[model samples]
Target chain A: MVKKKLIYLDNAATSFPKPEQVYQKMDHCMRNIGANPGRSGHRMAIKADEMVYNTRETIKKLFNISNSENIIFTSNATIALNLGIKGVLQKGDEVISSSIEHNSVFRPLMQLIKKGVRVKFIPCSEDGFLDPDDVEKAVTDKTKLIIVNHASNVTGNITPIKEIGKIAKRSGAIFFIDAAQTAGNISIDVKRDYIDMLACSGHKSLLGPQGTGILYVRPGIELNTIIEGGTGSSSESENQPELLPDKLESGTLNTVGIVGLGAGVDFILKTGLDKIRNRKVFLTIKLLKGLENLNGIKIYGPGDAGKIVPIVSFNINSIDPSEVGYLLDERFGIMTRVGLHCSPLAHKTIGSFPKGTVRVSLGYFNTEGDIDYLINSLKNILKTKA
Target chain B: MDKELKEECILVFQTTHRTLQAENILKKEKIKIKIVLKPRSITTDCGLAIRFNAEDKDVIFKIIKNNNLSLMGVYSRSGEKWIKL
Candidate 1:
């Protein structure tokens, strides 16, 4: 039997069909230049070491970071958040977060509460828009960190990160941004945004492979190291080196994955971030408009395509989201995500708790035909009660 | 011994990243250089050092200073001890 074509709309979860160069470079690095970076003095090790640095430089260019050493690699955004959150907050410290945060941020803040740390979760509007004023109102003298989700996973609503970052600055608190959803999809400059720390997944919009994530910390803000091991520097001292990356990054790096990430970033740079984002937004407008015209369909978040990322969440009248998702896949070979999307607070805020909305996320690779197919599929499902 | 001493200077940096960064900057400038393991006698943060011709010392120092790289020190070997240049 021939394989069915896949129309993947789960870019919010992880991008699919990465650029050809990503795959090619990863294979090349694995086959030929596979060596432990920063561990050996051999030629292959040096090559591997240079590959890692070059990837870091590419990421630095993408995010407009000044110092490449400040960027640390982790397994995923979750680990990066853990490192930043647990490393900064201590007993009696206060934190300010949002209601639309993913489990990565929500769970860590919850864990910190058990240790006497306080957190204020500013609620967003029903449409999933977080107000900068609400964040400013929650600030206190004890506030040590102010972290916000750059965009909602369920609603795809983009928050006013720059305004909120200024609030953190005035309050003398560290501003951390969880850019898991918007890192590569939108523009985020650490200097312009006054961001003290930012963490994001490389696999999502960045189009890198799994097991790659990034955390950028500003120069002055100090965080306790959560994990420490050999950084291939200052080997004489048993203690971890007191430096930028070596202080945070430990153990062998994912050379194959990092090299692939470099190629992915190179593709973005050559193609232009604005061009890639515009393509996604154009398709999203079509999807949102089509869903609005369909009977018995209620879209979530901002109905405006310009206000959100390339994601659409909606529900059919009285139909279970899981069933709709299943039929869309079983009958049409369309892939999507249903349920809370690991954001229970967002579900509750949008009044989709227990039952969640079907999220259709677009990627740079998606086309107009994919959107039309999805809309037709949903219409067919609603009409036939599939 | 005089000829050998005039030919090479070991440039050490604070971290492997700085060492590699220095290597990149110097390589682009067309400097004749080699990455070598740090000598046991020199105590530095990174385990690698760049070995270049002693004649290029003035230009190398200028480049290092302009780039703002964390240069730990420069050293040359004497009969038994490593002397700081």
Candidate 2:
């Protein structure tokens, strides 16, 4: 029996089949430089340390960050969000976040709410687009931070972050962007956009393995350390070092995963983000058009296809989303995400509340043929149901 | 026989990783450089520094500035003594 081909359409969750360079660099790190970084003076340890720093430099260049030390690595975007949210907010401080935030940002802010941090949710339309004017109106004297995701993971709608950033800056609020869905796929400059803090997952758009993420803090933005321990620097002092990265990053790091992330960033740099974005957009447009032509389908988000990421969420008439997801996987050998996608607030915002959507998120590796296959599979499923 | 005196400079960075980064940048510019253990005269941070020809100070400084390498300090070495440059 011939094995069926597997088509992965879940890049928004975690990108699959990372670049070849990422795999090679990760293997090389494991074989050659496998040691604790920043802890020892031995040759292998130094090599490991270089690997970590090299990744930081690569990330800096990619994000147009001035100080590489401001970028701190974490296990995932959730941890990074926790650090950013918990580190900055104090009692009686107000935070403005969009309704389309992932659970990673939502859960942390909820915890802060229990501690007296007031959070105001800027409403998004059914298309998952937030208004910058609403953000401006939401600001108050107590507003300490404005957090928004660059794009919605469920609907793929790109938020107007630059405009919101300007509003936050003029209001003297620190702007924090969750770029888990936009990093590597969108061009973001911390200085030009007036972003004070950014949190992103290395596994999503960055194409690195899971368990890697980044948080960038702008200069002079003092965030109290949430997790503190051995940073491999200032060993003599029991207190945590008062530096940028060492202050944010404590304990041993994931050296091999970081090396892989560096390679992934290098690939993005060499290939150019514009080219990658264009490719993903092309695939997304093709998928959207195909889905639009299909019968009994309800598509969500800014359906224009040109105004979003490569993610598309929809539900077929009278068909449960989980059933569609199951059929897509079991019969068609296509992988996709179904239901709330860990962003129940987003689902509710888009009016997909009780039941969710079947999300088909594309990546650079997905081909036009793959989109055609998905469309045909959906058409077949609809025919069977009819 | 007279011994020839040579002037050398050491670029100290906060971490060995940064010292290695400086080494890479200088090498790419074709400046003569080497990774040396942090000299005893200087305060030890990460136990590493980059040694290069003092005559290439202008070029090396340009490289450091251009790359934004986190350099702790620069020191010059004379006969049996190290002086801050």
Candidate 3:
């Protein structure tokens, strides 16, 4: 029995084959510095504490955050988004979000709606492009927050976040960006972009292991603490500490996962973000061009390759997306995602609701050869259907 | 032996994070410091403290002030007796 080569195109879900340094650092941390950080005075514990702080500092540099303490680690981006959204909004607050938001932001905002908070969505074009003017028009004096997904996970369409950020600033509404799909794939400056709060998944674009995520809160944003417990500081006090990270971060952190995330950030810094983005864009263009000529295939998103992340969504005429997904995997040993991609709002906006579309999300590790193989496999699947 | 240990002082912090941070800042400034278990005579808010030459007290204070570390207290040890400086 021979094993077929695996081509992973599900990076938008969670990155695979993380950089070698991520694995190495995780292993080293577990073996050498496994002590619970901020809890003990032992050398191992201190080392663990340092590693966590170093990761925060790395995140600060990567995101252009001025203060390291503003970055909080969570289990994943969903948890981070919950913290960002729920912590800031109060009753009667009006929140504006883009049409293309993952369940991470959408579900949280839905929960907020039940709490008497009003939520409005800025509509995007069929190609998932969001006009900054729509976002500006949606802003009201009662609009306390404006949340935008930096990029669409399903269609890979990049939103005009800087323009929206400016509108949010001028309107005096706090701007929160969901960078789950864009953190490492593109450049984001929390300061220059006027982002007051940002959430991201370390496991996805950051190239870290699962169970790692980040939330950046700008200074002077007095967010209510959502989850409260022992922060390993102010143990004498019965209340949580009133400090930057200690105020937001409670309980013991994921030290091993954080160290790995730090290593992943280090790798990104060393390799350079522009180089990674260029390669991913080139491969996506190649894939899009290859599939453009195929019959019965309708590609989704902006279709301009460079305007989006390295993700492509499309469908075969009259065929269920899941069926196409299954055939792509079993027949060709290629892995891709199907269905709504966890953003039903995006699907409905793009007219792929209910059935959804076949999505191929490329990563920095994927090559032109991989794109060619995916195109050829897609062609073979289409031929069989005919 | 008692006099030799008495020449040093321990700077205790409220949290292990701050204790480690203080050590890093002091080390970078070339100030000799050692992370030691908090002396039993000192209040144990955090289990660790920075031990350095008592003569370097002013320089240590400057470093802590520059870094804005939240220190619990500073105490000098003399033959097991902890004296608040």
Question: What do the candidate models score in CA lDDT, each in turn?
Answer: 0.90, 0.88, 0.87
Docking class of 3: acceptable
Candidate 2 displacement at residue A241 in angstroms: 1.2
Worst 10-residue lDDT window for candidate 1 chain A reads A1-10
The residue-by-residue lDDT of candidate 2 on A12-97, one tens digit each, is 99998899999999999999889987776676777787789889999999889987878999999889989998999998999999
TM-score of every prediction relative to native: 0.96, 0.91, 0.93
DockQ of each: 0.48, 0.24, 0.39
Which 10-residue window of candidate 1 chain B scores lowest in summed lDDT? B1-10
- Preferred candidate (DockQ higher): 1 or 2: 1
Q: Candidate 1 residues A1-386, lDDT tens each?
A: 33546799999999998999999999999999998888777788888888988998899998899879899989899999999999999999999999999999999999989999999999999989999999988898778999999999999999999999999999999999999999889888898999999999989999999999989999997889989998888888988888878788888888899998888888998899999888888999999989999998889999888889998899999899999999888888999999999999999999999899999999999989998999888888988994
| Consecutive 10-residue window with the lowest summed lDDT within model 2 chain A | A230-239
The better-scoring model by TM-score among 1 and 3 is: 1
Name the lDDT value of residue A57 in candidate 1.
89
User: What is candidate 1's TM-score for chain A?
Assistant: 0.98
Better of 1 and 3 by DockQ: 1
What does candidate 3's lDDT look like per residue over A115-195, in tens digits?
A: 999999888999888899998888888889999999999999998788998999999999999999999999999878888
